[model samples]
Target: MSAHAINDRRHGQTTLAHFFFAFVRGPCKLLSSGAWGERCRLAKFGGECIHSDFHICEDAGRMGNHVASELPKSCDVENLWLCERASVVMAKFSVLLFLREQWTVLVVTGTNVGLGFEAAVHLAKLKPKRLLLTTRDEAKCKQAKQDVEQCSVTNNIEAWPLELGSFDSVRKFADRIESEGFPINAFIANASIATFTYAKTQDGWETTLQVNYLSTALLSILMLPHLIKSTTASDTARLVIVASDAHFRANKLKGVANWPSILGKLNDEEYCTASVMKNRYELSKLLQVMFVREPASRLPNPTPVSVTSINPGFCHSRLTRSVESNLVMKLMVHVGKALLARTTEMGSRALMHPAVEPSERDRHGRYMSCVEVAEESDYALSEEGKEISRRLWEETIEILAKIDPRVNQIISQHLLAR
Candidate 1:
């Protein structure tokens, strides 16, 4: 059978969808059906072929007829078919993936720490036009910038100080980035506080809530303009929040109504006495997921900003060691860590994948674990949860409004800008 005859037969028997599936699954079937002759005819004419041989032929033709003649012998027809199909699929997907857009900048928080540091290092390899690495500690940010620069000379990475626990700090950081006049392509809310003590931040909010949830929400709102400015009709930017699986564990302790209040008082005691800190940490992580999903459902405008939450799996980090230090605690931590823990590099892989990989661009507003998008808790997406995140957003504005009306104004201005 000639290639044309085979295509006509297949076209008569199959739908376009089936053809696409077959094309992707096994283009060799197309080759075996004798599509190569039709492709060759197409190549001979002014038209083009969809197989890899066509591309090789075209490249060779660019050199000369002599080169073109040699290509048929030099290139394997089967491999060319596969490559052609792969290229076509990628090109079509890029229409939805936003891979061709330039000027997408990634803002990474807490870039100094274990997973954050590792993510920054890996993301640098992807060569985003600009990367903003923010942290509360200036020294740490500088070190992280140095490390990332060392790893890849191609990425334009810079450092800025951002203390998520304080509304003041978040505003200043956002202002600085906006002043730079760069649109944010992605934002990773990776900074978190896992203190055992029920401390209040300078802003007079619970330390856990302020740092892990409220501040990140505020920062996102403040940076919304920059994100929007960067997005095209064809492009959708992303916000990836690094949450944890611990939220599920904390939700299980729901029946103990007064447990949070009681634990708040005991937070200052030694590690042996402040076991409840584990629950506090878990609660904050839960809130982070809630904030992402809640806004995703209710945001008036799809906002061109896709919000995603990811659990990077367990990793052996300073944060993990901080909570489990004693012999028994260490033993349990060791077992869990060994079984579930990924290296900082592996843990950050999911994050970097979401941030830079074109494949994940369409998977917006989803919760992910180990690169697979997973379902979040029902409460996190419930109306009540949406209201909770809304209340947190409003209260955060009110608090910032009181501290510096200018800061609140700037944040509001940015959110509503453009």
Candidate 2:
């Protein structure tokens, strides 16, 4: 049979048995060519095609040698067109197979750099159907997309600019996604801001709290409806907050027993105090965990969404660059991190693992370190903490409403629609 005739017959069978038989027979035709040169060219095409199709075909060796035997050495299949056609066919088959099986979506924040970037890279390999990455900088988003593209070409991933500090930006971003009709299966509130000096967002809120906590809260609220709508019985939706060990330190320093009230009044002295500076970043992370835990605990019976918080451990990334830059501070930070510091890839494992791994029994609302579920501080798990988180949620909604009424209305409508 002609190669074309065999390919036509094999088109209907995407199963492994048929694919291997057809692939081998197609290339084995060239084996009859006595010329050594012709045989060599055929072998090249067979090898290249097999390499490209490895992910699609389950049995590696079965299809490989079959293609090698048929190709003639004289007929070099090095033409880009042939290569492109092979890739497209493989991709189409792979995608169809993937779609037939259950799939999930993951939304990763601050994917442009550091821990967020590392997490996105790892998650892509797990084969989520869709991965959405958000960053405040468009240029950074483009770079992130490029980085992911290099790693796993089959995964469908997208990047968008999302400035968490601005209510306007967050609302606009959410609106765009809603209008486009994208579903969210999981969300990671991983973006955060910290500085040795203080700064305010465009909306006049403190930069650290605004970016690290408020904006993330707003985005989650905005996206909650889609998350709920997209969830299925076969799958459990999740919200993973990338929190920190600094949370424990924050609880110790501030007599501030509550989460929201801690943000109530920050005098210059409180803001600049040595303890405050060191713990402010940690406090923001703690608030995030508490904030997620509050709503997560309140879902109706048989909740559709499960929430958890995790600390990626100390990593050598841009987040810690400030401490690494100064001589004395760098030494101190290095010494501290060495005891527990993980590389970026290692640090991101916990974050990525939680998103992909199935939930453990009775593991919701727990804190995670090194991907193993751990306990949050007693203060964070107390009734006072829950109350404080609830109050903080209310206060946050009020503040955002004042900043952008449209966002408040949109979120309210989303909740109501649910």
Q: Give the TM-score of each candidate.
A: 0.67, 0.69
Error of 1 at 197 (Å): 2.2
Candidate 2 lDDT, 1-418, residue by residue in tens: 2222121222321233322332333222222111111111122333323222212121223434355344445434443123222311122223532452236678999988888987788667556778899888889888888898776564488899999878789988888978988777778888887666566677777777788888887777777777777767755677788887556545432444543355554424455466566666877887887876655655554666667788776675778675456688788878756654556655665676556555422456677654555656545666776666767767777776776566566555543221
Residue-level lDDT tens digits of model 1 in 41-127: 112111123333332221211333453454444344334433232211111112322334334578889988788887787667555
Residue 301 in model 1: shift from native, Å? 4.8
Query: lDDT for each of the candidates?
Result: 0.59, 0.61
**Cα shift from native, residue 104, model 2 (Å):** 2.5
Which candidate ranks first by TM-score, i.e. highest?
A: 2
Candidate 2 structure, TM-score to reference: 0.69
The residue ranges of model 2 lying beyond 4 angstroms of the native Cα positions read 1-102, 252-261, 266-274, 382-384, 404-418
Candidate 1: worst-modelled 10 consecutive residues by lDDT: 32-41
Question: After aligning candidate 1 to the native by TM-score, how far in Å is the CA of 340 from where it should be?
Answer: 2.2
